[model samples]
Target: MKATIERATLLKSLSHVQSVVERRNTIPILSNVLIEASADGAIKLMATDLDLQIVESISAQVEQAGATTISAHTLFDIARKLPEGSQVLLHAAEGKMLIQAGRARFNLSTLPRDDFPVIAEGDLPTSFELPAETLKQIIDKTRFAISTEETRYYLNGIYFHVSDEGQPVLKAAATDGHRLARVTVPRPDGADGMPGIIIPRKCIGELRKLLDEVEGSVAVSLSASKIRFGLGSAILTSKLIDGTFPDYSRVIPTGNDKLLKIDPRSFEEGVDRVATIATEKTRAVKMALDRDKITLSVTSPENGTAAEEVSGAFQGEGFEIGFNARYLLDILGQIDSDLVELHLADAAAPTLIRENDRSPALYVLMPMRV
Candidate 1:
């Protein structure tokens, strides 16, 4: 196999595919990326970790059509250190791969391309295309709340499904039992009758990074067991969690009439300042609310107490509530708009938060007892 590609372009494509390669691999072939230089003047880089896979193709001047497997990390590192604007020449023969850029030349061991596990896309019938920005919004807003607990494997991913609320909408929801985030976007035409799927946490992180570099629309296809995202020259495929997501609609509070409208930035800043004195274990902050202002305070047995005040248009009788400082800051950081509303019933009940009730995105946070 022989191909020549620009250093910058090769580095970008390598960065995308190599991330799917696990550093600690039990199988030697899994540590390598399958480089296939086809006759059509392009080279495809593929990497996988059994559960997830990424394939990226870039335009290259291909003189020969062949395939080879070389160390993913080795190739990425070489591409990263190569001079800017340089052309990278890759040639594989006699069980070795040669990388040449400017005056630097390196030879690396190559594995048989046949040894690389290429997951076959059996049949992904349900497919849809959504604008990149909307997909980015849905993912970024909810992924932070994804659970890390492995015992409840089902809760460790974002649950994606189409919801029919007068109009069909695509909803992405994530929770860690303490906090829940649900975001909705207008459903695409082909998404009707699609199966609900839980995209694992790893896939979410990788896909979110890819979406940052994508524009226009992204094609998505899925079956009951797998989901695939096509972002132009890059494709990501992953296995779906087999467990059913819990009915989350019941957890959202409906009767919390106590309302507070405040600048999310200010509230988030206040939480950061007060949390400085909070206990590391609990990381709890207390909020005392009145008609015009909310006092954010924290108490630590080892460290002294800290407090700050932020003004808001809070309705209903004044009440004090406690919540995890980290959780409060996380939800606030996700708010893109200036104004945020909080609906509260009491200190013991779950609080509902959004830009407003009409907003497509909603959050439910379980209050912590400080």
Candidate 2:
């Protein structure tokens, strides 16, 4: 295989596909990327780690049509160090893959193309297209709540399903039994009959990073076992978690009457100030909501005590609740609105948090015993 590709273009595609290659692999072939240079002036790079895979293509000046396998990280590292605007030439022969850019050149070990495994592309019946901005919003708001605990594997990924309760909309939700975040976008066409799928946490992380540079819409297709996303020049396919996600709807509070409306920036700042005194173990901050003001305080036996006041609009008598400072910041960081609405029931009941925007999104927080 012989092809010449622009350094920037090759580096970008290499960055996309090399992330899927595991740093440590038991099988030698699993560490190498499958590079295929077609006669039609395109170079394809593919990498997989059994459960997840990424394939990306870039235009290249192909002199011969052939395929080869080389280390994903090694090629990316070499391409990344190449001078800007330089052209990269790739040549594979015998058992060595030669990479040349400007005056620098390196020969890397090659592996048999047949040793790489391909995730069977079975029929993915459900297909839809989601705007890149909408998908980014959903992932940004909900992924913070994805649990790290492996015991309940279902909580490790966002649950995506169409909720047609009052209005037909697509929802993405994640919860760690402490806080829950749910975001929505208008239901896309051709996804009404799709089953709920739990996209693994690792897959969501990678997809979110890719979407940072993606615009327009992403092609999404799924089955009971797998999910695929087609970004402009790249495609990602990942296996869905097999376990059943818990009934998350049952925990969302519906009748929280007490309302507290506050400036999100001011509230977040007050929480940060008070949380400085919070213990490292709990990182708990107490929110004492009153008829027009909220007193954020932290009292730790060892660290110290601190308090601050954030004024807001509240109708009910008063309410006091405690939450993890880190979790509060995570949820608050995702809110893009100036006003934040807190619907409260009691100290123990889950409190609902929503933004003051038309775009539908809500968060539920379980109080901590402070």
Candidate 3:
């Protein structure tokens, strides 16, 4: 393949596809990206790591219609280091791929284009278009709660499904047994019959990069076993996790009657200060609530103890609970409002947290025996 592509344009396209290529590979071809130059003055770059694949198309001046495979990271690095506005020429001679930009030239080993594996397209039964900003909100709010433990593989991905509310709404949820996060947004058209799918953690991370600073709508296609997201000139296709996610609806507490309203910043600061004396293993902070005062304390046999008091509006009975300080801070960081509400049942039962009275996002944190 022989083509001339601008340095900036080539770097942007390479940045999108090269991330899918694994650094270490058992199959040599899997470490390479397939580059195809067509007669229509366009170039296509494709990369994959078995379960996930990315294909991007960029305009270039084509001298010959051909295809070749070259190391994805190596090519991306060379393009990034080239002088700005410089034109990069890529050509195939004998069995090596030649890259030339101004005075810099390099020959890279090439793999046969036929050896590149392509993810087979499946019959997607449901399709929808979602605004990129709304999609980003769903991922950002719930991704932090996704489990990293490999043993419970079912909880390692975000659960995407339609809610059972009176009106249809799209919901994204994630939990790691210690904490759960749920966010709901208005459902898009053609998403009524979409089946629930667990999107793998790695796929979610890569998908976030594509949604950054993007506007307009993203085309999404879903099936029972696979899903695809179309982002402008780039496309991402990933295999769905084969495990069933737990019924998260049952985990959210419904009847927590004790209410505490406080400034989120104040509560967060108090927790952070008192948590300093917590043991490294537990990192547990205790909360004691009275009529209009809340005391955050941490006690460790070897590390001593710390206590900080903050003012809040409380109703019902006084109560105390213990929780992981880091988990509390994570949930608090996601809240966008000045005041946050905490609904408590007891010291042992799970506590519900919300940014405000009518916010669509909810967080449930399990209590620890301090």
Candidate 4:
């Protein structure tokens, strides 16, 4: 297809779609992006890794109607390096896709568009829409907790399921053996009866990128085996994990009775400083909570020890607990609020963390015995 698209426009569209294409793929076509001209003055850029697919359209001037595929990463690099606001001319000729902009030209090898595997259409059992910001929030907060273990395939994704509370809720949960992150938001009107789906980790990462530019409501459609996220000019579709998510409700502790309110930034900083001396094997930062001061300490036989005291509001009796510093940093970085609340029962009990004054989100971290 011959289409004249602005460099910035093409780059923006490619930036989203090409990320779905793997840089190194055994199948030649899997690393390429399929470009096709629509009837109107819009061009469609599509990419897939077999498991996840992304399609984005950009306004362009179509001179000849056709379709071709080119290396996704190569095209992205070319577009990115081209001059800003430059007009990009693309055409299929001599079994190669020619990209021209300003004083630069590159001929990228082409593949048959038919070879690319597109996510087939399926009857979505349930459909609903939610604000893109909210959708991003759910994914961003809980995605870090997703298990990376390959043996337990079921735990490798964020589980989207309804909560046991009476009201409609959308919950995203992920757990490695070490820590768990569960976030809940009020469900939209039509999403009350939606079935649980475990969205794959790669799909969630791409979905998060798609949601970045989306400001309006994002349309969501899902079936028992697939889920689709549609933004204004972009769409992400993926196959859902078929296995069942474990009963996470039982793992979250409800008996934690101690409460501590502290500045999220200060708390994270203390953890970072104390963790400097933590052993690589443990990476654990120990917390000593007093009446109104919290001391973070870590000791390593090889690196010595470190201790830092941060002011906080604590009402419960003094207690100490060990936690993986990386996990604490991950959760703290995602929390936007200034103050954070932590509920604790004992040194070994799970710690419940919540953004102070915000009820829409809560985090639970299982403590380590030190």
The 0-to-1 C-alpha lDDT of every candidate, in the order given, reads: 0.93, 0.90, 0.92, 0.87
- Supply candidate 3's per-residue lDDT for 166: 81
* Global lDDT of model 3: 0.92
Task: Rank by lDDT, highest first.
Answer: 1, 3, 2, 4
Error of 4 at 32 (Å): 0.8
Top candidate, metric lDDT:
1
Compute the lDDT for candidate 4.
0.87
- What TM-score would each prediction reach against the true structure? 0.98, 0.97, 0.97, 0.95
Candidate 1 lDDT over 1-370, as tens digits, reads: 9999999999999999999899999899999999999999989999999899999989999999999999999899999999999999999998998999999999999999988898787899999898999988888889899999999999999999998999889899999999999998888989999999999999988999899999899999999899999999999999999999999989899999999999999999999998987777759899999999999999898888899999999999999999999999999999989999999999999999999767889999999887
User: For model 4, how big is the CA root-mean-square deviation?
Assistant: 1.7
lDDT of 2 by residue, 14-87 (tens): 88889889999999888999999999999889999999999998899999989989999988999989999999
RMSD of each: 1.0, 1.2, 1.3, 1.7
Q: Candidate 2: lDDT over CA atoms? A: 0.90
Model 3 backbone overlap count = 0
lDDT of 4 at 30: 92
Which has the higher TM-score value, candidate number 3 or candidate number 4? 3
lDDT tens per residue, model 3, 4-97: 9999999998998999888999998998999999999999999999899999999999999899999999999999999999999999867798
For every model shown, the clashing-pair count is 0, 0, 0, 0
Off by over 4 Å in 1: none
lDDT of 4 by residue, 76-105 (tens): 999999999899999996679888998888
